[model samples]
Target: MISFSVDFWYAGIGAALIALSLLAFLLSKRLLKKLLAFNIMGSGVFLMMVGMAQTQNDGAADAVPQALVLTGIVVAVSATALALVVIRRFALASVVAALAAENKAAENDAAENDAAEKNGAERTGSDTAVSDTTVTDTALTDPNLNKNGDPQ
Candidate 1:
């Protein structure tokens, strides 16, 4: 008959957690999900370390592994915070870049319209009003423009 100790259970569970978390992390596309999976994997590592420590010390609590786990928890929390900040910045940058591209396209379109109107007026000797209304209408009707007529 085989005997399963508490230490063995802990190690087994920890290994399973590590494997599942690793898979989740790799398969996740979102930054937040990946971060959560990474944190779970860290927890699994701590559990495995504690289980190994107890096994090595004849089921007695060891100070080294406990201290290491404590330190790791602190570092993990700090790293998570840093990662969140980075993710927020990255999202903001992407939004800004997209808005800039839309604005550039809108500006280019307005310039082309103005140039075309000027050429048509010169050819026919007729004056066309290149007013703000024309530009505003173009901007307002644009799918890329926001409600305020700003390019999104």
Candidate 2:
């Protein structure tokens, strides 16, 4: 009369899913990240299946299921390795590009400072100061200058 059913609850697939979910949560950041989330998720699914195998009838585990787990592990490991290499290369390129952009910004700032010093000298009507070529070039080429100080 449905008096006992603890074994049925323990043998259900929910328990297996819970264990796999825990694993996936832990490995989601370090092993998966943005590139290989699907691969990591597949590995979690494989583990869930393996856990389910523990509840096989007659207390016997099947070889086919175990073999599938091994195959999936191999494929997942290879995919994870390849994705990590690609991500590393991408990060390196990003760093190089960012450094180049920073250097360009610094050069522009220096040029601006030189132009400001030239303007300040001109505003003081000083005739004994050295002429700044960078400021003259900007005054001739830059649209931000006037007809006298920003002559185009």
Best by lDDT: 1
Report residue 22 deviation for candidate 1 (angstroms).
1.1
Give a tens-digit lDDT track for model 2, residues 63-136.
77679879988987887789788667645543443333334345556666544344432322232332454223
For residue 28, give model 2's deviation from the true position in Å. Answer: 7.8
RMSD of 2: 16.2
List TM-scores for all candidates, in order. 0.68, 0.48
The per-model lDDT (C-alpha) reads 0.67, 0.50
lDDT of 1 by residue, 7-86 (tens): 76797789999999999988776778998999999999999999988887777888999999999999999999999998
- Candidate 1: deviation at residue 74, Å? 0.5
Model 2: worst 10 consecutive residues (lDDT sum): 143-152
State each candidate's clash count.
0, 2
